[model samples]
Target: MKEKGFRYSILASGSSGNSFYLETGEKKILVDAGLSGKKISQLLAEIDRQPEDLDAIFITHEHSDHIQGVGVLARKYQLDVYANQKTWQVIDQQNLIGKLALEQKHVFECGKLMTLGDLDIESFAVSHDAVAPQFYRFIKDDKSFVMLTDTGYVSDRMSDLLANADGYLIESNHDVDILRAGSYPWATKQRILSDKGHLSNEDGADSMLRTMGQKTKRIYLGHLSKENNIKELAHMTMTNHLLKADIGVGQEVKIYDTSPDNATPLVTI
Candidate 1:
């Protein structure tokens, strides 16, 4: 029997690497390829999927943390890569080295809608240090999902784009108090706290609250720092704020965390 809903999984997530798998009955798409091709293959194997099952990759930006394995995955697996023109320039200048070109890498402009296999994708600009960082809204049949990570701040524009998503993967990068007392260098600390750096727990919670509604099903917090925040604290911070807004946990919506080292179970719609 065919499954009633779309399926999504975080192959791995963190500063070391980031990758996600999404399947909509007939089509499969990977959101990012941060891990090595070998590691990615292993992760897929753990979930009973093969590398060849992937249809394409949607890059949020050109950051090493998100594209570390992109070139290798695309070249070896012949997976189509999609991103904006600026991302392409940055990707091209980077040391792809001996990695396979795969073929002409596909390009799509931010704020435009496109079709990938049987799924629909809408790209939007997001705040970050990388060239043309973007967030994605994906639709398949009647289900809608969004992936908005690597963003420094939440904006009205981003809120509008993510509104009413059935599933969301958003960045919750740090805890403010922890970041203030952490031992990192002053310059690096400043960058992380800046508007173009990373999202704080509060920032992430606020964005979720803005998009919270009866229809939103799941929210997976992503890209948390190893040094500055603890998983429980990050979850509590967002949880408390959302509760104050009268968003009941496991009632109106479900919240999840993506570990920095490995994959989470497939989050289905």
Candidate 2:
């Protein structure tokens, strides 16, 4: 049988910015708009989508790398922007971002399920330093999809929570050894290794192994560190660990790396 409706594209992902386009065959939504407004618009056009075509924009947290273009996107598209109350408060307190219209504001509580078009979307809390760090779980036609980024470590509960996704975009931020020896300051290193910081490549790969099932077919490694991790290193780390665990990546799962400067090709699930 043909796969039911789902298509995903990562526009940009890294310390610089992050965003994605998710379509449920009927509905199109942006997970985040971290790059500049003009940049995001151009990226959308690259994929044959326009700002006005979005159903909504969901903000994962208040970090500048995730919210830099949120206000600008909302203003331009008059798009519905959803975030947890705490994240909204934090974003509003920062005047660097442009203004969003009153009608465009929407608040969502973590773990509370909501819907956009035919897809059921649930935002769950994640271990990140942001005030209300969360990631999404979207279900459509019984197919589960998730996008997790900027997470420090994976908890057992989180692993179980994410299992059986048809597609997942998970953060593999850095290599622990490289990060330790890298030029970033000691304090910065500590933060990246902290429970509430970013996920090391090992941690990310292990989470994938734990959570993946036959239904879990597509894995996109995202939010890699520029200073501490290269794309080849991150990809190799994940593939090697999976092979050691007797889970062959190319056999039952397909893996890809997200881009820091461009959009990945749209892959339909």
Candidate 3:
């Protein structure tokens, strides 16, 4: 049965910065703050929210792309930042001021479910180059969503975390062939293909097929590389593979690619 009241939306989604707002029970939590504080404020205003409305900020990693605006937002909003020790270390390296430094932040290991207001937030390790990149699975009422991005490989544990999600925000970075032939240097290409690197489009689709359930409602393809992949190709590849698996793409799932430069219309769940 669906929860009587629960809502979520992506404030912004793309390679530059990622942020999402989840309203569970009576709490408003932001999953990340990678975009500029000014931009975040504008986006939140569009959704009828202010920075003060956020209860906390949950960080998935310390990559520059994910934490670029953390420093400014934290100081301005005084938001509680949640992350693990390793992630904190990387953030500290950025030398962000005030609340973004992670010194007075709350640190928690991945793989445990924690409650914030009425929401159940679970964090799990992901295969990325960052000190401790993590993925999130959020449950509110009876609805749940799994956000799996930035990782090069999907382990059994990650698969388990995603197995029962109602929606998925999965990374479909580069098309392997396109990446292989692109202008990026060989070393950079090798880095992206490593186990602890970014996930390619095929890898994302493969992971989705492995973890999807009948309850899966939508797939939001995210974190696409601007250099070597196109949104249409990612969509078509995933669609074809899902068909071969006896899964009618739109029958049980609706797949949408994230905007490479801006936010897609808020996906309410």
Q: Best to worst by lDDT, what's the order?
A: 2, 1, 3
Q: List TM-scores for all candidates, in order.
A: 0.94, 0.96, 0.92
Show how many residue pairs clash in every candidate, following the order shown.
0, 0, 0
User: Number of the top candidate by TM-score?
Assistant: 2
Q: Tell me how candidate 2 scores on lDDT.
A: 0.86
Question: Which portions of model 3 miss their true places by more than 4 Å?
Answer: 1-5, 96-104
Q: lDDT per residue, candidate 2, 1-269, as tens digits?
A: 64586887899999899998888766888988889989988888878888888878999998888878887778877789999999888888876456777788899899889988778899999989989898898887888888888888878898888888898888899988899999999999999899889988888988888887879878899999899888998899888987898776898887898887888888777
What is the C-alpha lDDT profile of model 1 across 19-134, one tens digit per residue? 98888877887888887888888888877788888878888888777887777877777778888989888777875423446464788899999977567889988888887988
lDDT of 3 by residue, 41-64 (tens): 887787677888777888898776
**Considering TM-score, where higher is better, how would the candidates rank from best to worst?**
2, 1, 3
Question: Against the correct fold, how does model 1 do in TM-score?
Answer: 0.94
Candidate 2 residue 256 Cα shift, in angstroms, is: 0.2
